[model samples]
Target: MGIVRNGHEASDRWSYIRRFLGGVAGIADDFLGWWWRGKDTLSPAELAAAHEQWADRAEWRLAQRAEELASDRIKRYLVTSWTDSVAYTSRRLAAQARGELSEWIPQRERRPDLHTEARAIFADILTELNIQSQPTKEQSSVVHLRKAG
Candidate 1:
């Protein structure tokens, strides 16, 4: 968490704030891989082909989302990160689908990291959109103050 410095002040008026989210994604990737290690279900070549297919699907979807959010540059950045992440993970999953890669391998298991990194990159965009993990009391506080008057 950090202050967001806009062209104005740092009194929470226009300053930027940093946010960190999604510890679960990273943790789950590790746990799932560790739990499923020695299972070879398909040939390496087939796995590679599946991975390629998954990557293609992910990339196309991501591009579409990016286009939808094009009006907002900050939002675009966040969406782009998300799309890139899907593409990256899809590529790897495609490999897994072909059985060329183990489900528990480090790279294979760390899929959540890709998402986490994307979220981090998109933090600013999220902030601009006013998205939050939880609702803030600021709105209620304002109402309370109004009633007191």
Candidate 2:
């Protein structure tokens, strides 16, 4: 009976852990999507959902892993989650700073204006993404601002 009970307990633990891990993986995916919202062409609601999902997943992962892993693993996960969140937040902040990415339309109507708009937006996006700097008065990283010729 002891062996049988132990087997059942192990099975239950495995099932719980598997579900927890699945949730973590799902959140990680959502975080990636949210981070790459501009690049991926996800809708606003979709992006929001991704952010929420990632938060949920990270919280769940932390709670579950808190008990099982060595303190180092828990710390690693915490750091990983924090870094991922920062990356996602930074991407969104950068996109918002660019202003051209207000609405990320994946299938833009192929008009001549679309090309011009995309070029401008791309330049702005690249500037924000490429040029890393300290936050400015506006609390956003300084990207090169084109002076009026």
Candidate 3:
């Protein structure tokens, strides 16, 4: 009775997420499918709803964010973001394969530790690009020549 109380399941479970579960993705999606049981089966109607509810918006959000960044900075900033993701993924895969991740990463400090890792990688790339050493030019500037008698 205590376990099956009303509103308990409703509050604890996000039933809507079931709609999006499928072979549509890679490792993460596969893991999710494995985690879900018979009762948590995905329905066809819900799958369509999931596409309408989240997937479409995710694509739109990606484009919108790219536009916002472009308006704020140069295209290189966008390229840097892509490179950062690639570099971070490669580092994480290598560390995970080595099985030494736990040695340096505490379960409790995981999020912050990962963030620090990514930041260090990004900083290294920035240094390699020599971006920090360059100074920005002013919009308006004039060269003055002195006349000698």
Candidate 4:
């Protein structure tokens, strides 16, 4: 019965992990919907549809990345690390969405460097998905101001 009990315990642990991962994935989806809201003028339903598309693309990209890793263990670790990062970022974004926080960075100040980094990540995803990037008003003004300066 010890062998059966060990197998059951392992199965239970795997089930718990799967559920936790699903919750994190949901949080990431929620955060993406919130982020897309400020980027586009789409209605909530349309934004949700777009979010689904983007999520699928992201998953595909992540799978491709995982496949590049040398070992199955390393691939699993990479995917878990990526999932945890996304969950943490999503929590921060959700706080911002609820007006509990001001940017991801403190100080009520904009971080152009971080913004650029984020845009580059999104640009890669967009390029992979064959979607065009839309410049925000702030992005457009920054270009104009740079030219003027």
The best candidate by TM-score is 1
Superior candidate under lDDT, 1 versus 4:
1
Clash list (residue pairs), candidate 1: 4-15, 4-16, 47-98, 51-94, 51-95
lDDT of 2 by residue, 2-115 (tens): 112212221232221222223332333333433444324545544444444444444555555654545554355445546445444544544554443554333234234434
**Full candidate order by TM-score, most accurate first:** 1, 2, 4, 3
lDDT of 4 by residue, 34-145 (tens): 4544435545444444334333433543654564554654345446446444544544533444445544543113335444545666677679677346677889999999
| Residue ranges of candidate 1 with Cα displaced over 4 Å | 1-42, 92-149
TM per candidate comes to: 0.35, 0.29, 0.23, 0.29
- Candidate achieving higher TM-score, 1 or 4: 1
**What overall lDDT goes with each candidate model?**
0.47, 0.43, 0.40, 0.44
Off by over 4 Å in 4: 1-38, 70-72, 81-149
Clashes of each: 5, 0, 0, 0
- Evaluated against the true structure, the overall lDDT of model 3 is 0.40
Q: Write the per-residue lDDT of candidate 3 for residues 4-117, one digit (tens) a residue.
A: 222222111324433333322231222244225422354545433332333332333345456555654335344444434433443443344344353444322544544564
Q: Over 4 Å off in model 3, which ranges?
A: 1-42, 48-52, 71-149
